[model samples]
Target: MNDTATPLLDVRDLCVRYETSGASSWRRHLTTVLRDVTFRIGAGETYGLVGESGSGKSTTGRAILRLADIGGGAITFDGQDVATMGRRTPLAYRRDVQAVYQDPGASLNPRHHVGRAVTDALRRHGLGSAAERRARAEEVFVQVGLTADHLTRYPSEMSGGQLQRVAIARALVLNPRLIVCDEAVSALDLSTQSQIINLLMDVQEQTGVSYLFITHDLGVVRHVSHRVGVLRAGELVEQGETKALFEAPLHEYTRSLIAASPASHPQGRDERRAARQARRRAGVGAA
Candidate 1:
């Protein structure tokens, strides 16, 4: 869908399942989490995957990060079959693909200095000497709007926004081609969320990196994504360019989601509320 010469990430008919415990230990059932999920992200592009809870949005990101087992289909990254990659993922791939989770504080160890998060990643990849790694860490910290001095502080010493910036620096230090942002901004306040979203866009413009942004916040998706995908019950119900999808969604589920998203301004609050009430009375998208 990106129409790039070659997409940075391509997922086709991806299927993921997990075995659930049944009535007895000897009996188990396989529950499919993703079914025929497909999408593509190009270099420097942001693809927003949006859905409510249990919609398989995060599962898709996990599959791409190689943290989840793929039950079927193919995931090709930069022309390589990621799904077929053996249990031991390549170090190059590890460096090329990184993740920034929702809880930045939890992502960093409470015992270690915040700087260690970036330095440790560099050390694992054998990128540079200790001095070089430290310097690189400082540079990326500044890039994410944090001072080099802040790196010496512990996670508990910083605010949520600051911690999130540190997490972004850690992911950026690897110079990754793509980053899976799993609800990366959902934990922050409105102002902080806007700042982080802008920071990500600036970083992409400067680095040509791709993003697979998985979140339940449609407002954030509309603000940050170039393209959007709506997932329901482990399947993609609709996907298209951001403007078109938001303005004229084709699928019933997609329309319902858009209608349910809080309006950006107060100008049409009463009108929108009345429309929702009408839809509810008609038994449309009822909970």
Candidate 2:
């Protein structure tokens, strides 16, 4: 963990609800997506949120980014309440917090050059003149392992890894203090996933930025996160320092997630499988 007295992002008893139509337009019900979920991320640290599909992992990220409505509790970033920021989110807040989603291709527009993603953000925040924006875009591209020539290419022209790099570049161009990376590397191959993970860690080392890395990959979480929180059915089931939590998970759900994650090596695959079977037979099913 960061060991800092004050965390960069603090989420306290956070609750999120969504209004869904029932049988008809007049019949609607509010579903609680997140319940009293609480966690903290220190500056320059990575906090991994892990869960299976429909476990509220992405919903929590959306709440932090102010894309989802908060039914109760609070999200404090840099000591400011995000939910109370009013209907119009401040430009400074937009500049301070950014997101990198799972599908980079969908997040980008195919009609415009990939460089436009970064340049448009700069233009929105009034960061610099056109010339400066282009220059800055080129700078961030290089920072993310892409060359200036990439600025002229459209999304269709680049590979998956390249598109993801562009997405990271777009988030980095703003010089945000915190990044909400929702399944950022889940779509890539193992090799490319490792590369992007290292790239993110390197960027954090250099820039002192924090990351809310939300993913179901326990292996990735162990490799990158300083601390981790396990979410199950819209609630936090376990949370602690990465090493301690993984080695000695107090919650049965956490143990199941760790067991379900494919081992990095195949040496003890059978033994691990047998153990999992035994656990399941003993009434501790995998989550």
Candidate 3:
């Protein structure tokens, strides 16, 4: 676990709304999709938001990136609140907070070369000279396990795993402080998923960057996350240190998820969970 006391990123009471059809107008009947979701990530910490489809994990990530409108609450990154960021400040925020989407093919522009796509953010952030950006793009390709020859290829030319690697390479190019990986590995095969997980851990070891890993895979979370947050129906139901939460959960929904997980056992699991939570809370009380 990270020993750092101060959080690198802090999200508080964040809410997002999407406007569907309404009686007043097209924009008037706004639906609150995500409600008061909150969590924290420290520097070099990997936090996973685990939930099924339509659980609001993507909405939370998008809200922080300002891709979704913030209906309420604060997203603090590097000690600055993003919800309150001015136009001039958002440019810098983009340099620090990058995103990787689930579908690599859809995320990449088919018209652009792999190298061009990877260097787009570098150019936008004005990281270096043209030659430097080109060189770095090629370097990041290797860093993400892609070959140097891929510089000229398009997203359509690569396999799903390769496409995802390119997406990761592109996110890494900017050296962002935090990366919101929105179901980033869900489309890959299991073997490829392991490779990506190893790559992420390796990158974090080399650089102090943290990750906001959003996924439905509980097994993946068990392996990669230092902390985990469970979201259901647009609300954060439970969150704690990964080991602590997995070993001892306080919420019924969390227990239900554990039971349904492939890794769970059928023998006295509910009783075990109850005992664990009781012991944990007792220990906390003693402390």
Candidate 4:
């Protein structure tokens, strides 16, 4: 919405690599995971990063959070460089830039009550007394469309959707400026995913928090993203307004991705069947 101001998060020429080793000496090689990726997310904007698995989409999110070791590039948050943050400074950064992972079941501690998990950040940051943290935790729970009473339950006791709402509450408890939603809805069923996506957008609208929403689902991306960026093998081949890009994808890879989405069209199913039949006929003739 506010296009005049500086971006809340800026990433420039980010590159990441991993080392692989063979059985013999001197056989090791470096595999590039992300290559010269650049993007910016303004305050309250949802920037969707969509790609197939192993496309380095998740790695990019981790790199912004400093979970991955970067080979090169600059990641700046609110004009300050995040990659160069000192050990203790990252704690502060964590407060401002939180994350909700794909699996809330895994992200939450089964041993702890959901209330404690939500309040942990407030406690660790020394924001308030135990009673204050508890009260604030309940407020966030309500904000994320959960009853404060649910906070008494453990992660395992809650359904997948309920657990995810709690996970979102944990992120909201911190009042973060940017939340890296790394496939945050992918694990849920379609109806639940829709609920989560709507909740995320609602939260963003209310709090003005930005999201770096990473997912393999182009249809979901189209629904939630203000802008879309398509990554192939770590390279951001196309980035544009979501509607424009989806209506007329510029890149071949981007077009293929949209076409491959099973939700794209009913006609696509017939086309696929026809293609399969054609392939079979061609094989028979060749034989």
> Candidate 4: which stretches are off by over 4 Å?
1-4, 25-27, 86-88, 264-287
> All predictions: root-mean-square deviation over Cα?
9.5, 9.4, 8.6, 11.3
Report the C-alpha lDDT of model 3 over 1-287, residue by residue, as the tens digit: 45457788989999888978766564467788888988889988899899888999888888877788888988888788888864445677887888889897886788988788877778887789999998999888998888889989988798988888898899899888999988888788878887887788778877888999998878777777889999999999999987799889999999888777776222122343466578787785311
Whole-structure CA lDDT of model 3: 0.83
Better of 1 and 2 by TM-score: 1
Clashes of each: 0, 0, 0, 0
TM-score of model 1 (CA atoms) = 0.91
Candidates' lDDT values, in order? 0.90, 0.90, 0.83, 0.87
- Rank order (by TM-score, best first): 1, 2, 4, 3
Query: How many residue pairs of model 1 clash at the backbone?
Result: 0
Ranking by lDDT: 1, 2, 4, 3
Local error of candidate 4 at residue 227 (angstroms): 0.3
- Which residue pairs show backbone clashes in model 4? none
**Model 4 lDDT vs. the true structure?**
0.87
What is the TM-score of each predicted model, taking all chains together? 0.91, 0.90, 0.86, 0.88
lDDT of 3 at 5: 77
